[model samples]
Target: MFQPRQMTKLLIAASKDHIEEVIGELYKRRLFHIEDYVRNEQEEWSGYSIGTSLTQADQISSELVKIRSIINNLEINEEQLPKADYTKQSELSKKIASDLPDIAARIEAILLKRSGLEAEQKDLEQKIETLNPFLAFQHPLEILSGYETISFLAGYGKGTPVLPSESELFTSPVRRGEAFNIVAVRSGQLAECERILLDAQFQKVVIPQEKGLASAAVERYQQQITGLQSEIKAIDQEFETIKKQQQLFFVSSEELLTAEIEQAAAPLRFATTEHAFVIEGFVPTNEAVSLVTSLQKATGDKIEIQELEILDLNEEPPVEFQNSRYAQPTEALIDLYVRPKYTEIDPSLFMAILYPLMFGFILGDVAYGTILLVVSLAARGFVKGSEMGTKLIQILRNCSVSAILFGIAYSEFLGTSLPWHPIWLSRHINMGGSASHGVEYVSHVPELLILSIWVGLFHITLARILGAKNASVMEHGEHRSKLMFAHIGWILVMWGIIIAIWSYFPLLLMPDLTGLPLIAGISSSALFGGILILIGIVFIARDNVLELMELPTIISNVLSYTRLVAVGLSSVAIALVTNYIAITMIIDPALKNFTAISIILLIAGIIVFLLGHTLNTALGLLGGGLHPLRLHYVEFFTKFYRGGGKIYNPFGMIRKYTEAEK
Candidate 1:
């Protein structure tokens, strides 16, 4: 419950011929986390290859690429497609070997034709646009291009340019919106003509290759474009139909092909020799026996599975946490910080208990709790079958339950007190005040602060106990005993200090001991507390003298829990102010008489009340959720947890698009 699952290293050796069988068995069982064999060039024994070469690996990889490309080109949305039918391995292989080639060839041909038509369409559109400017000129394209001696310039200018009479320049000026299309041809001294055109702000335009007027050329290009567009539309429709027919097949084939590629590449992780192969991996200790039996059976006793007796200090085993269903959701929170090392304890169970408890204490409101519970329940249904969503909903549900329990104790519904009596003294209740005005149980600052400190003390104490247990697991001999004693000393010192504070401080919750006899008797607790502190210091000094500096830190850590009370008080205050304004200024006055002004004020007050409460609830959730998590992560987890372990990743498939037959 407190620790991660134990792991054992398994060294597997088999003949080259049985390597495939061994790999298949291990993958099917999904029990082993393969450790890639690293070859040390300097060591002769490490230089040998341990696994047989995967000759089909490259072929499988190529097929996988092609399959992915086909799927991508089809733009298949797996969510919109129907689930694929389950097919045997042999059937799938044969279908892919025979049918895929033909399908791919046909699709490729269509795509190629579509690409050519698109290019042609684009070219025709460009040609038409280029020829549109010359439409005003009534001249053949051949005439415009054939003249070598007479240089002709056709382009748009800001206004018509003055033609040079001596050069026999023909000017065709046509207005086009804000600009004029000018076509001029001169016989000689073209440089002077060009300068005049440039002075008129003329920008040159290129003529198309068609040997006709610009209008005729545009008409011809448009007809071709229309034809090409029709062809492209037909090709797109064909693609759509093909996509609908083959999306499911492509999705299933991709999964199968990917799996095959992974299997073929498995040999790359093994160390191979001329006739034998060696594979090293970690498997759960509980399942090691069954996995070995299965592998032996699958390989016909050709493979040898040996559990290594010694673990290398440099190599850390992969961690797999085994937690109850209720505690599992807390793993997500734990992972957000760090994954526990294989040697460290799993804190999910502890977090499961503490996280919600603190959250409820911080957000103690019946109405908000009810709302959260409803929302969480609805979310659970909506996010069914999604692992992350389910975990989040579970956490919310637990927090909501805690909130409700605390709300009842606090006698709070939303930010106001309900008519029902509280099981315990409500935070709003003035414990020592008169009852004539009806005892108001507002969460007094001092009381809440004291409660928060005590909670913090208890939480930190538990953390230290767990940390001591974890230390005992990792240490040995005299060192383990010394660490354990130090942890005990710290625990004693914390309790002693708490006891001494209760006696010495004139706290609201504690009884007064002012007389000489009472003072003398209670002073012993302070003395006992001092003695415990000295004992703790003595024990921890052996580990490191610097650790003594942490004594003040314990006080600070306990004080940090005051955030719970501060946040809860803020929420209550906001709610109280909201209720006061709504009731005293608007709702109460309006209830006296239903005048127009009063009714208007009443409606406005209702709006203000709802908005204010909504904002307060949101803030409460944020503060309530985050501060509790901070307390656990920063103060609690740091005490015991040394995370950063690798997760176990086994070779197996959890098919969603397709299933295998039993």
Candidate 2:
């Protein structure tokens, strides 16, 4: 798995010799063939069309058995089955396809009718289920299917009065409409007419408003009426069920049936006469060789297979992109992140080494690192939001080792004295002072930053080298020499320029105008760098004299690494702030006397500890790593890197869902 490898080649051939035997065997095995007439990626297989024979006839036949079970459950007979002829099936499919809207309308009408019946039936059942046998009644309320309008006397009222809707929206005194007649009916007269309402889109209808009660008593009356209103709704539901059964007779089950051999030959019916056999599919790399060989032997030399080699297909112009080598992490790290663009090199390798080192150097607290390591380990398995959480935890876990190492170097152990203190610090401290003087401070953090810059330079250089390699391979004709010279010349210029600037420019910022003259001694180095840059620009721009101006522009772009030092200093400054706050709390006796002060100190200390580390860790990840990646992608890759090459995807069995890759 560690070894890098190139993609394999595909072999293709064409033959027309054993067409009949091939078709027969394919039918017997229930294996289908796919044809894409257009030699491009967007073409779809026409096997889904009606009248096209399914090559997986056996598979479809198996599916038919399931359909038969459903039909049997519904008690549909053979005579009820539509004709299963291949021609008839095709014709029926075409007819269904042609007038789908009309069919939908009919289906909807039937469903509406069924829904009314269902609602009515459900209302009746609920009323029955809610019956209380012990309730007294003057006379039994009889349930009937037909309507009756009868009123002898109003119940529980000394007098009765009626009010009509006379508002502007419904009825205005100025513009009166016809008065509607009304009667109270206890019997179910409307149930028969509701069948017509099924085709109607009346899911909800408003009851006409009547008024004769005081506003304060209306709520009480409504609670009583709501209970009765619920009963009628149940009755509507039952009526709908009966209407649904009648609709099913119109839809044929034949298309849903399994016809094994016929389904397998489905695709063959769509193939053109010019193409004897067509096969389009994916196979896993491991199984590809064996499957291709077996198929060749079975079909004999009369059949031919053609494969498309996508990755090596030289059909497009090349563009530059980041090389994968610099970012590659160990195999142990791959399970944590999304797949990188290039599989040859994992990007995590540089991150895996540098991240922990930076964290440990800045934090340098044994207790903090240990706690982070433990928490990261625990959370890695349980964090569930984004996958990035898992990766972040893994990164923290890796960095914990660096923290331990740096903690040892700094001689810090849970804010206590180390097992050994530096000899130089021993001379400068009184016996009662805190352990800051205990460990010889590595005091070499500035040197470490320098080392980091060197590492960045190396990675960037390597990226340029790969870019040249890409250019050499892609532009192999006469232009190859020019490309090679440009890449080499640019690298030399960048190296010299960086060295000169690093050694001399920092002195310019020093509080000494006298030392600024020392920069002239390195003047020759700058001159060399500028000349090389100019030459590279001229060559890359195809000997155009105007392109020499691009040298200064590109050089400025390459020198954005000053942000590295700026960010590293920020990390150190954050740590100092935390230390100052923590020490100030412990040393001030007046503040220590108050409980609130101690509480504030505790809260602030914890906050700074957690917040500072998180911020530094993020800065380290982005500024330390991503900026270097940007250098590789922009500066180095600009020399030459082709990005449009198609990925090598082999043909294999594809899992639809839930199954893991083989």
Candidate 3:
């Protein structure tokens, strides 16, 4: 489509009672794009105000939050869930009212219980570790502590302390890592012994609060830990079961509640009085009547609807692309750069056609194209949710098709000629490739390069024409005419340069155009081209003297297209070299001998061939993808495009897991 869908403004004013039904129809049908209302205080001393959210919006929101919390606690990711079961909205609402609270309470209790049990298990594990170290002492726990007359210290340190001869001291034989010690001293002399232990880098460890041998206590604690582990495992199993059972319900509920909340809050964007409400929005002209009829029917024809032919000078309507299915993928790039304004022409169709041709021209190869097609097909499903990524993949798919078609034309399968002669012209004739194909065709390198320049000329000329049209629409007054003329001047200058090159050096420049009718009519083509160039410069200078500086761009932009030839030739050369090293030098010699050494070389050569081609394929995808986009962005779109349009965000939700009953 050349233009976006035509839109009409609809203003609806109705009694407050009909607002609920009206909102429901608008949301469910997904037609309206609401233009939010902002109240002005000085509007003739107005008493109107912005409407609040609809009744029970708060209730629905609270319940939605609880459902989300439950889903999160259960770690129920929608991606990992099985296919959702379709159910009526009414059924889902009833479940929310009756089923959610009970499920929420039970799940909460289980989580709380699981947390308490896990805490107890952690505490028991610590107790076991503490008691295990004391086993080396071979002492009853009660004897190590709770002494008033005698003070004791139990810890692990770098070395044993040097205590008084009168004090009782003990050290473990296992002293490789750290020494474990127990030392008792009289209460009056405890400080001196503590200092001596501290000096040895002592780290005090607490003795467990228990009685009996350390071994028995450790055994009892381990038993308690085992019990706690069993309870935790059961809780986990229960959670997994709940996740499986309620995954569909959770996903469906979340989507439904989200839609419901949006509808309920739709009133917030409306202008309201004590008894009436006003709604304003845009709808496609084709669908406008249907929307009005549906709303009136839903409200029993109680609402008053007015269609106004009003234009706001300051604000433009939101832009929704009206590209065909084939051209739609180009929207991603347009959005990435900047969306086209409502008044300007959409370039999706232009980009859709040119981008693939440019890409195929640079990376034409049947094998590479087939690989790209296969990869894009396999990845389509995974990127379905990502709109931009999906569009890019689709673009890749389209470009690959172009590449295959061009590869056939160039007589290249991967890096060599096909079994038959090319359907179109071949690129490799001058590179000794004609001998293998046995066609003896002359190389078209110069012709292709000339063709590249011609492509640039046509593309830039089209851009100038589009730019002039856009200037007429977007520009105004004296400046608009001047700007339009500047675009025209560039076009003239580019054509002049091309004609001069053809007249002076026919073979070195473009394919011989001397026999053409236009060239034949001109007595002195060089002089005619110079005159045209001078006139263009004068027109460009009329806008601003600085504009003349850009005159040289006509030359550079045309030469930029020469990359189409240079880059593609480089790719072909690489492929040729890879085949030569792999098949001709390595594999062919190995097969002639048929020995162990030969077989090994053959395998290595095959590896070399695959790796080489793999590298080339990656290079093709990158070069093919980026170069075409660069040519479009840098060389083509810059001439006409000045995108800064707002994206169209329609007021509705896309349902995925549930269906609404009629």
Candidate 4:
């Protein structure tokens, strides 16, 4: 669809007595995009003010925080968790009151114990590392430091320092080539020991205070570390068991609490007086009547839902994409860039059409497309419950189909030509003679490059037309008319350049266009094209004289699409090289020889084949996806799209794990 869903403003006014019933009905329908009633944004009166949260808002929020902490501590992954059956709000609330506290306390206790053990294990390991240099020393650790009467330096030094006979010293080359020494003396001889060690360039290193033989201390720490590790491992296993048993409960409770808190806080967005409340929001035009009827039925006509005049909006209505199912997944792509303005065209439809088409055009290999198709299907389960991930997988599935269709036309299979000649174009029509490592080059690539340029021209022209329409709808009078003409000027400049090129260099990039009417005394299309360009400049000048500086941009934007062909050709070339090296150089030769060394070479070739194509496949997917996205965001959307519109998020949650009662 060209436009977002049509929306209408509504005023929901009701007695405070029916607030609960009215909010419930609204949530059930999930149609409204509520506007917050803040003093800064709305007219303030003596009695009218923002409503407070409903009863138990704090209690529900506190319970929800506990559930989230437990989930985080257990490392519960949403995708890996199984769904629970339909759970009523009453039932979930009861479970939260009865079961949540004990489970939270148990998990908290077990995790704290595990954390303590891990911390102890780390400390022991550090102590062992510090004592490693002294392991070979024929001395007890109790003699190392910790003495008030003794002064000592323990660290790396140049060599053993000469000290007073009353002082004691031990030195060893422990850290690479550096000497590690421990010098100790009675307090009376401390000054002499310090001077000698300082001359030796001693750099002190800290050591843990402990008692016993150095070897015995290290052995004791290692034992403690081993015991702590075992305890921690057991704790981890218990956690995994608890996660398995309680995942369904926690996941379901999280959703219910989250939704409950949302409803409890709904009043914060409403304006309330002494006994009445008013809620202002937008709903799809088609749903406005349904919403009113549904609320009346549920509240027994106690709640009032009126359709207000949709005029003089302080802010634009939230954009809800209205597109066919085939184009729906592309909405995620648009969201990554920016949501379209309600007044502008939704580019999802065009993106759904072109994004895959361009990707498929660039990666036209049947084997690679098939591989990608299988990958997307296999990965669907891994990324379950991720909406963006699912949408991306869906988009990839469509792109895979497109790639297969193009691959059929190109008659390519894993960088080699199929048995039959190309139905449309041969990416590998002429393989180059003997390349390095038995690799071959795809030389007949000019036609695809030329086709990419043509695609660019069409894509840019479409953008200009849409840009002009958007400018017309969003601007007024002189400004509107000027913008429309400027868009047309861009279109003309591109075509004029092509036509002029055709006159000067016939059949250079495109087909011959020699059958054009003559201009003035000359029979050259250049004269006619130059005239169009001059007139286009004048039309563009009416909008802004400075826009003429961007005239060359039309050429650059069109030229950018050439990546569609260039990236594909590079992929094709890699595939050919991979096949040639694996099959021709190693696989084929080894099969004939049939020896042990040949068998080893055969395995090596298989590795090369798999790894080379694996790398190429990743590169192809990246380039294929990013280049088209860039072209759309940078070249295509800049023409017509004025995004940054707020997304339509209704005041309700989509229950993924729970459902209605049967």
Clash numbers, per candidate:
17, 57, 0, 0
Query: Could you tell me every candidate's TM-score relative to the true structure?
Result: 0.84, 0.51, 0.89, 0.85
| Model 1: per-residue Cα lDDT over 376-472, one tens digit each | 9988778866777788789989998999999988888866677777664466633234221233654466867887887888898898898898778
Alpha carbon deviation, residue 53, candidate 2 (Å): 8.3
Per-residue CA lDDT of model 4 for 301-358, tens digit only, reads 8877777886643236888999999999999999999888888889899999999999
| Native-referenced Cα lDDT, model 4 | 0.84
Q: Native-vs-model 2 lDDT? A: 0.43
lDDT of each: 0.79, 0.43, 0.83, 0.84
Ranking by TM-score: 3, 4, 1, 2
Q: 334 in model 3: Cα distance from truth in Å?
A: 2.3
Q: Which candidate has the highest lDDT of all?
A: 4
Off by over 4 Å in 4: 41-47, 107-158, 167-187, 198-241, 312-315, 429-447, 508-520, 524-527, 579-609, 658-662
Deviation (Å) of 22 in candidate 1: 1.1
* CA shift of 485, model 4, Å: 2.6
Q: Between candidates 1 and 2, name the one with more favorable lDDT.
A: 1
Model 2: which ten-residue window has the lowest total lDDT? Answer: 166-175
Candidate 1 all-Cα RMSD: 4.9
What value of lDDT does candidate 1 attain over all alpha carbons? 0.79
Candidates 1 and 3, the one with greater lDDT: 3
Query: Distance (Å) between predicted and true CA of 411, model 4?
Result: 2.0
Cα misplacement distance, residue 574 of candidate 4 (Å):
3.0
